[model samples]
Target: MVDVTELQRQHIEKITKEKKLITIKECSTLTGIGERKLRELVHVSGFPCIRFGKKCMIVSSLIDEWLINHIGETF
Candidate 1:
């Protein structure tokens, strides 16, 4: 049987693999945007992301540029 905690650990490991690509959690930490809000923002056009299975891998640079464009130059 698959333990729930084990599944969660794998998910965490997948999301935090340490690279230029990062997960919603890391993006949220860097951008101060809530994870749920970040997920919603993903549906917007031209939001840079990659999908591996069910995980949404966000590019740190793209999100930064996105915020600056959408929010304001001050962002």
Candidate 2:
């Protein structure tokens, strides 16, 4: 039988990688940045985050732009 579990995992991974808006945890994983630092960044002005009540989502596409804009700078 085909390994449905492995297939499902692969599918999920593909979906997450293709996602435009992702949770803080996913953003940390994708950017190799620690969750703690990411949480702080989300609160900074012009950092680019969508808030839903207490839940916060990071825009995947803006990550690169943010990094480039902050080059040679520290938060």
Candidate 3:
């Protein structure tokens, strides 16, 4: 069971890294940020997200860029 959970985590990491767009839940998993936090961030100005109806998708590369750009900033 532990091994299976590890494999599932690895698979999620791979998908998060490889996919151009990822769901909020995937972003939360990848970033270790809560889904609720991600949902709030998605609504913030300049957050990198695409909305399809009520669902939101995050741009993976943009997240990287956002992280880089935020380096040294106090949260």
Candidate 4:
């Protein structure tokens, strides 16, 4: 399994705030990762997300950590 470096985890942890929930569009804006791609990732098992009625919400820190873990991926 891919692991997040300490530095990357620290950066991601720092972004975790009291208002931890975020919309998919906000996630895309903050990460520079498109909404469609985020949507795809959300469906993967273990990908952090909570279904709120018809909306899918995610924890900002979880997504950040996930992105860090995937940094070395190709395509």
- The models' CA-based lDDT, in order, is 0.74, 0.83, 0.83, 0.75
**Candidate 2 residue lDDT tens string, 1-75:** 899878867864674679878888877766778999999999999997899999999887787798889999888
Candidate 1 residue 54 C-alpha distance from true site, Å: 1.3
lDDT of 3 by residue, 1-75 (tens): 268878878988788678999998888877888998888888777889999999889998789788678779644
- Candidate 4, residues 1-75, lDDT tens digits: the string is 656576656654465564488888877766778899888878877777888887998887687687777788743
lDDT for model 1 = 0.74
Q: Between candidates 1 and 4, which one is better according to TM-score?
A: 4
TM-scores of the candidates in the order shown: 0.66, 0.75, 0.74, 0.67
The per-candidate count of clashes, in order, stands at 0, 0, 0, 0
Residue 54 displacement (Å), model 4: 2.1
Worst 10 residues of 3 by lDDT: 66-75
Residue pairs clashing, model 3: none
Higher-ranked by TM-score: 1 or 2: 2
Lowest lDDT 10-residue stretch of candidate 4: 10-19
In angstroms, give how far residue 3 of model 2 lies from its true place: 19
Candidate 1 per-residue lDDT, tens place, 1-75, comes to 879878766664565465668878887866778999889877677888887888888986567687777764221
Candidate 1 vs candidate 2, lDDT winner: 2
